[model samples]
Target: MYDYAVIGGGIVGLAAAIAVGKRYPTARIVVLEKEQTWASHQTGNNSGVIHSGIYYKPGSYKAQFCREGNRSMVEFCQQHNIAHEVCGKVIVATEQHELPILENLYQRGLANGLKVNQLSAQQVKEIEPHVQCLAGLRVPSTGIVDYKQVCQKYVEIFQAQAGELRLNTQVQKITSRSDYTVLETNNGTFETRFVINCAGLHSDRIARLTKANPEAKIVPFRGEYYELKPEKRYLVNSLIYPVPNPAFPFLGVHFTRMIDGTVHAGPNAVLSFKREGYHKTDFNLRDLTEVMTYSGFWKLAAKHASEGLQEMVRSYSKTAFVRSLQRLIPEVTEADVIPTHAGVRAQALRPDGQLVDDFLLVSSQNALHVCNAPSPAATSSLEIGKAIASKIPEQSLLASSDCCLVTTNS
Candidate 1:
């Protein structure tokens, strides 16, 4: 018997378990990971950019968590001796027609309380010499860090508080009793008073298992990237993003300088057939069938058919991907880049063709489910965990009472 059982060993799940353990020191806690290692999904495969809350809407969860997360992440790294860099990023507009949109982005960044400055073409050149832009927004707070390392650190800290980790445990069913819940897993069954469903890819499915009606459905979008050759790494100083297409769910292809001192280019978003699929042909028929059958999926596809088609074209044609990148830096060529790793984003879409923008949480009598956690989630994991820990019913008890008084099987 455990006080809490956390499903999924992604950064968010691990962070949640860590937060819970701190608040409830004597409470038994366990984390279930379907994979052999943690951060094997979104957290491990992301672009590794510590977002500065520039692109998110002001007063929204994304904006709040990102800004707060940026500060906290820097502090956490310093305290734990983690390797990270506060390399700033630039969002540029190459064509004159994009100037107004660029200005709007700058204003939005200002509203979001980010350290943003509008840059002239010459100023942009001063920062990123090889880049071309009509105008741009410089976000100085953006940075990079290996999220996999961050996840590892959390695992260490969580274990210090006596938290247990069970890997390669695939959950099959969940049943809630009057007091506790029973989790049937591939490894063995576990009983716990409370559960946190931080299962990244299969979050919605987990919620349905607990009889909760999650309004949004998970739609996987694969982001394919290319790394710049060693000689051309200077093309980007830090990060170079395009003026996002507001109509689409993804931030358009961008260049990022990773913490490992390598610059990567072009993460073109396309519909992924497999949830964990990194390759172009890594498809799961069941996943594809579920997405194809969802009315919301078709609605979203029809709404952004042009952007969707362009993404597919870029995925198949390297020249097209380079063309998109050339919009920011005219010097980039197909020969200057090579295929890098890819990541699949789990975006939640509604039947009305709306993309769920914020960090969405849905809960039931015995379980709390994180339905949508996208970019900046890795950066915001610690703070997000603290927030989620506060919401659980056991939180108040843990903060004030002794675990010896609460009977697990009562």
Candidate 2:
């Protein structure tokens, strides 16, 4: 029997295991991943942007963790000799109506204690020659990195500390007993004193298996992207984002110059028929029926029907997607970009039809469930892991006091 059994081998799960091993050296920890490889889902298919704490509400978990996580992530990258860039990004206002929203963002950034500066159209041009904007907020702390590589390093350090990893291991059911939690998986049965559920896409399902009621349901929204043609990459200097529409949960289509020197644009959010569906044609009947019958999904759909329709249009029409991109960079055309891989976001929605905008953690007798961790999660993995580790019950730690103590160098 192990002391702790972590579900999912994504970045968050790996980070949690690493943090647990650090805090309790004697505890036996194991991470179970359904996929044969780590980060094969959200962690691997992300835009790989290291977000600054500018967009989140001040004093919120997103803001605090993002602020601290940015520092820790950069430090961790440097310590491991990983390739990363602290290149800044710009949130621009191309239309007159967007100016006020841009100003509000600047004020929010300031309130969050970031070194943000506003730039005029000419100043914006100076930074991004091909971009046209009436005003912009330059966020110097925003950066980019290969999160997959980072997750790999996390696994390496975690395994070096004696943490066991079981890939291609799907948890079929979970039962909590008086003393321990029993997990029945496709591979076999395992017993552990405690369980941490970080099973991103199917987190709610996992929680239900443990006999806990997750207040929110997981709704999968696919974000499709496009990469600029090699010769057209010069049109984007770094990252260029539009003034976010408050009515929408998405950040809208943006241009990002990746660490590999390729420029990626888009990520228009559309409802996915399958939880793991990466292509438009991919569909799952069970996943479809769940969302169709959910009251929260219908309520949310009714509220944002127009925006949702527009997203669907963009998903099918390259011209419409290019037009959206033209708002930030006027020179981008449909011919200049090619469709790339899409990522599915496991967004948590409440019964009242509201999206869970913050980091959500639900705890039971001897288990904790991370029901919602979207967007900046990849950037906030380390701090989120530390936070989850700190919440593990004291009794669990005391129970493993007699095991062999082995502190990790990481």
Candidate 3:
């Protein structure tokens, strides 16, 4: 019998399991992953940008965790000798009409307690000589790191603490007993005192296994990206993001200079047919049906119809994508970039068609389910893990400590 079972071997899952180990050193904690490898999904395919929490709303989990995570993640990389860069990023306004909105973003960054600087077009050029913008907001704390490496270190730490990790162990069902939870998996059946569901794309389904209905459903949005060709890499020195459309949930197309010296650009958000689908043609009938049948998805589609259509057009046409990238860097052309890998984001949408904007944790009987964690999740992972671990009930399971603090209503 294990004290804790963590599903999913992604970065968040590993970090969470590690945190639990630190909290209860004598407890038997196991990390269960469906895939043989770690962080092969969201963590591996992420843009590798460490967010500064400037875009999130003040007093929200994303804001607080992201701000703290930026520092902790950097510290972890530094201590472990991981490859990372604290290269600052600039949010630029290309058109004259976007200047006021840029100012609002600057103010929002300040509200979030970030040391941001409002920049004139000339000042923006001083930082990124190849870019053209009417105004800019420089975020100094933004950085990049390979989360897979970070997960590797987390695995080392957990294993050193005598934690167990079972790869290729996909959870099939969950049964809650009076004292412990029974988890039926492909590998074997296991009984544990508690379960932590960190199954990124499949988190909601895992929650349902315990007979808990998470108010929101996971909808996969594929973020398509392109890398600047070897010859054109010099155009981007660091990250350059456009002022995101407040009406849209996604942070629009942007340029990023990765840690390896190659620059990546244009992660246009488009609906993915499969939760694990990375390519345009990749499809899964069940996944498509769930999305098509979801009223919330249809409502969200209707709400962002225009932007959605544009994203679809750009997905099919390289010229259109290049044109979108040209907004941030006018010099980028069709020949300047090559198609790169894509990462699907599991965004949670409520039945009322409203998107869950914060990191959602739902506490069920003997289980804590991470229902919604997207975008900055990779950046806010360490803090998120600590938060989840801190809320776990004591090993003895007292009458007063029954359920964890569920952030979102179930």
The candidate that wins on TM-score is 3
Question: Of 2 and 3, which scores higher on TM-score?
Answer: 3
- Minimum summed lDDT over a 10-residue window in model 2 is located at 401-410
Clash numbers, per candidate: 0, 0, 0
Give the per-residue lDDT digits (tens) of candidate 3, residues 131-215.
8888899999999888888889999998999999899999998888887999999999999999899999999999988877788
Ranking by TM-score: 3, 2, 1
For candidate 2, write residues 195-297 as lDDT tens digits. 8899999998988887777778999999999999999998988899999998899899999999999999989999999999999998999999999999999
**Cα deviation of 362 in candidate 3 (Å)?**
0.3
**lDDT tens readout by residue for model 1, 43-84:** 999999888988888877778888999999989988999999
Model 3: colliding residue pairs: none
Clashes of 1: 0
lDDT score, candidate 1 = 0.87
CA lDDT, candidate 2, residue 262: 96
Cα error, candidate 1, residue 349 (Å): 1.0
lDDT of each: 0.87, 0.90, 0.89
Q: Give the Cα-based TM-score of candidate 2 against the true structure.
A: 0.96
Q: Give the 10-residue window scoring lowest on summed lDDT in candidate 1.
A: 401-410
